[model samples]
Target: METSDLAALTDRARRLGADGRRRVLGIAGAPGAGKSTLAARITEGLQGRAVLVPMDGFHLAGAELERLGRADRKGAPDTFDAAGYVALLRRLRHPEGQEPVYAPAFDRALEEPVAGSVRVPADVPLVVTEGNYLLLDEGPWAPVRGLLDEAWFLDADPGLRVSRLVERHVRFGKPRPYAERWVAGSDERNARLVERHRARADLVVRLG
Candidate 1:
């Protein structure tokens, strides 16, 4: 992405919250497609008008995943608390009081979610949430799209995406060989599933 593109996106995001009536902007994309990067940039551009509430915070605990026998496929759609995420979005959409709403954050180093790591002020006008399954239409995920005032789907070169995933895994303590295998298997599968919902986005951003 170029500087000008980010400026334009920032300007656009600014307008989404201009009315001061809380708006939820969602960023959805396959792993390594830059959803979080873009979301954080857009939020930063808003200059305190927005708060980021990532979907990764809803990820099931490692213990829960192990008990459910889904530990082997950690990034799958079912491994997250989809309903809980949706509920939080709804709360953000219509905040009832002055108290800031607390949100969970994913701790990459620990590979788990830390509760109350994010505080969303009730008065903030925009909430930017990003994740892999925001655009998914199955089960509890179906309501996610409707809750968003606008959604952007990010796209990038497949090879680059996979390479980024591998690097990220390795950075987080996975051996390079094991990272490659996980990206090729579990992560790639989730990426394909995410691709199916590209057409549902309000905008499709192709990252350079």
Candidate 2:
């Protein structure tokens, strides 16, 4: 992520948002491949012209996951409200009225989705969304790719990505050993799924 590359990406985003309608730029990557970081950087670079709408915000609540027996595979594609996410994306594409549209946000500390936590003003031109499944083409997630004006897939060394995932889990309150196990199990599976769809993206970003 050099300064030059960041500047170019920001400039590209600005151009995409220049059209009359809102433009969506999606950042897709495997777990710990730095999707969120890149999305944040783009938003910051755009100043007030862009707003972030993370896909993680649409994660099924822990209680709902437990009820569906999906608590163990929390980060899996099936564990999200895919339809709801798609609906939100549609609303963002065709904003109604003059009011800002509110989107959900995920709270890492509480491990829950907070409703209406992010507001995307109608006047904002660019909406940056990052997630593991943005490029996924199966089931309900299929519509996601069509909605985005541009999609970027982040590529990183597998070992470094796993290491980052382990650290992230630990930072979020999981015991070190448990985090390692989760990374090896659930996270690894999700990572593979995300990688499988890398070719579908408009661009592949090397995040070494």
Candidate 3:
């Protein structure tokens, strides 16, 4: 069933504590799976004590992708800097006594990543992070599996996922045909890859 209320998540976070014992929650799912939406809702329900750090901020820039001939494989597992993301999460896992930690954020309008977009205060105690590969057991992503306090895998109907991807691509300026191609080629492929990781997650959530 879909979980809209985050009271359970927040209560768990409070018990985990911050500054080395903070609860780090991970919501993993494929493209159009609503991972970001769920993370945002959890953080919002937790009020000011919770902060979100998305993995999308680590996406390679368009220019860089062109240089590497990877622009066409934008949503592939290889398109992101998984190591960098893990390193940042590692740092957050052990927050200093009273020092805040900063994390990057992705800009939808500029289609770029910005540094220091989210500042997680020292005592906030709860961190909700969402991404596609969080449960994947490959490469640098392998280490990510051992970091989270609780990992959730989200599942949505394939048709709905495709529809959402097409709408999002068009809203982001891609032509209809190009958007469909991306959803079929890139997004669909990534979805299959992520589905294999559902077994590794602590919970599997179904959403419409």
Per-prediction TM-score to the true structure, in the order listed: 0.97, 0.96, 0.92
In each prediction, how many residue pairs overlap at the backbone (N, C-alpha, C within less than 3 A)? 0, 0, 0
Query: Could you give candidate 2's per-residue lDDT for residues 1-208 as a string of tens digits?
Result: 2222777888988999987579999999999998899899999999899999999999999999999999999999999999999999999988988999999999999999999999999999999999999998889999999999999888888999999999998999999999999999999999999999989988778755
For each candidate in the order shown, give its overall lDDT on alpha carbons. 0.92, 0.92, 0.84
Q: Pick by lDDT: which candidate is best?
A: 1
lDDT of 2: 0.92
Q: Find the 10 residues in a row with the least total lDDT in model 2.
A: 1-10
Model 3: CA > 4 A from native: 1-20
How big is the RMSD of model 2? Answer: 1.9
Which numbered prediction scores highest in TM-score against the true structure? Answer: 1
> Model 3 — which ten-residue stretch has the worst lDDT?
1-10
Q: Model 3 reaches what TM-score against the true structure?
A: 0.92
Residue lDDT tens for model 3, 1-208? 2453457655555555544457788999989988888788778876687899999999988899999999889868888889999998888888877878999988877888888899988777778899999998878789997989888888878888889889988998889999998888888889999998898888777754
Q: lDDT-based ranking, best first?
A: 1, 2, 3
TM-score attained by model 1: 0.97
lDDT of 1 by residue, 1-208 (tens): 2232778888888899998999999999999998899999889988899999999999999999999999999989999999999999999999998999999999999999999999999899999999999898889999999999999898888999999999999999999999999999999999999999988898888767
